[model samples]
Target: MAISNKVYAMPPVVDANSRLLFLGSMPGTASLAASRYYGHARNHFWPILYRLHGAGVPDASYEDRLRFALAHGCALWDTIASCERKGSLDADIREAVPTDIPGLLRAYPGIEVIVCNGGKSYETLDRHHGMHPEVLRRAVLKVPSSSPIPTRQHKGLEEKAAAWLAALSPFVKPRGDAQGG
Candidate 1:
């Protein structure tokens, strides 16, 4: 791969109150270009989050969407810190450097769940830090990818949202409620 193919992940969106850590494999081309997580118009990440929180629609601006997630104790990040890949697909990824998840877990002890956003993110996390004590203690879930690409099991936005909700409901709280309901 050319040097130009090397893509780096954005800094994690986290805070002291964050209790749900959502991790993707890495940012796709659209996300990288926009300098935001899940920037693709068709991507289901934002929509699913909004639906989970009972927010009728996602906020038009990226910053507002981010704030909403933070308000609900959701933290967004990627498993891969940097990697070389020709395109957005996880299969194209090569020379992957994983992010310091354990360090982040240590820093934010309030985080109780680790939700891997897709197969690649979970695979990388398991391969790299599966045995770590911090990871072992948390509720780690491998959910379907929020990518626009459809699979046999998850073909539509609603399907994806349902799957994500099933995995996240136990940890997620209502929009303004700090305590889990």
Candidate 2:
């Protein structure tokens, strides 16, 4: 038996030390129900994260993953603050309330890059939010959708995705999660 969360996508947690930030559009049906990020069965987020670190995500708790991300100077967040989804399809999002990133960036001055978790998140940021050729100077790499919704490989896109994660790997160190506090 699984519970369901109906409000919105859970915000990715990070501490002051996070150096990289990952942004998705919103929580999918699976994620929302689990009250966790990237809960979809087919979603490759876990695998990709594990691959990046050359190990598993440490534990089942999202907090643990956040700790891993923080230790590696990485942060996780969604592109949309709120949205109405008939189910989990990003294409089904009706009215999206984008998150205010500049504010978060200011609070945590260490973040160097913002990686969009999927193509939808990427398009929303690039198309709707006015992050264009100039805004993309920060390097908004459109990575593969980790969603298990469709397993069809996105061709050479995986290489770019792996590279993006690799760029942040040097910072990951053996550190326990801060959630205990």
Candidate 3:
């Protein structure tokens, strides 16, 4: 496939109450086409999140899902602000421009943890903004990609959920508990 022209990431889904920031590499082809994060049908992102938080169904409307995430103090964004790539694979990204993570952190001081959704997101954060004082102060968790593509270690949704839950449970409260009684 020919490399496409520069593709930009969608604006972050964040707010003052956001306590956990989830960073993906960039929107995949399906996600970009649909203008929704983790839009692909096979991706485990939504399912994992719903399973972990147990509030909304994974099949809920896009807006509902976004609200669910935000209600749980979770924010979502991509590490790469813009890049050229032939397809959805992270390896194909070129001329990558990183998102202003430090700026986001500064704006949302409530965010206590940064969760890299995959290796590319983690690598991008580490390579581009790791040294920033804002980034250095927060906890960063590198979790397995929630993609449907199987790996030797994380071979299915259950495995991915286990890993994600383990990494995020301390910070992500269920919807009922998120608002704080």
Cα lDDT tens digits, model 3, 38-125, are 9999999999989778654585689988988887788999999999988888989999999999999999999999999999999999
Off by over 4 Å in 2: 1-7, 56-58, 131-137, 151-181
Name the runs in model 1 displaced over 4 angstroms. Answer: 1-3, 176-181
Provide the TM-score for each candidate, comma-separated. Answer: 0.95, 0.74, 0.93
Q: Comparing 1 and 3 by lDDT, which wins?
A: 1
TM-score winner between candidates 1 and 3: 1
lDDT against true structure, model 2 = 0.66
Could you give the candidate ranking by TM-score, starting with the highest? 1, 3, 2
Give lDDT: candidate 3, residue 74.
86
Superpose all Cα atoms of candidate 1 onto the true structure and report the RMSD in Å to 1 decimal: 1.7
Ranking, lDDT, top scorer first = 1, 3, 2
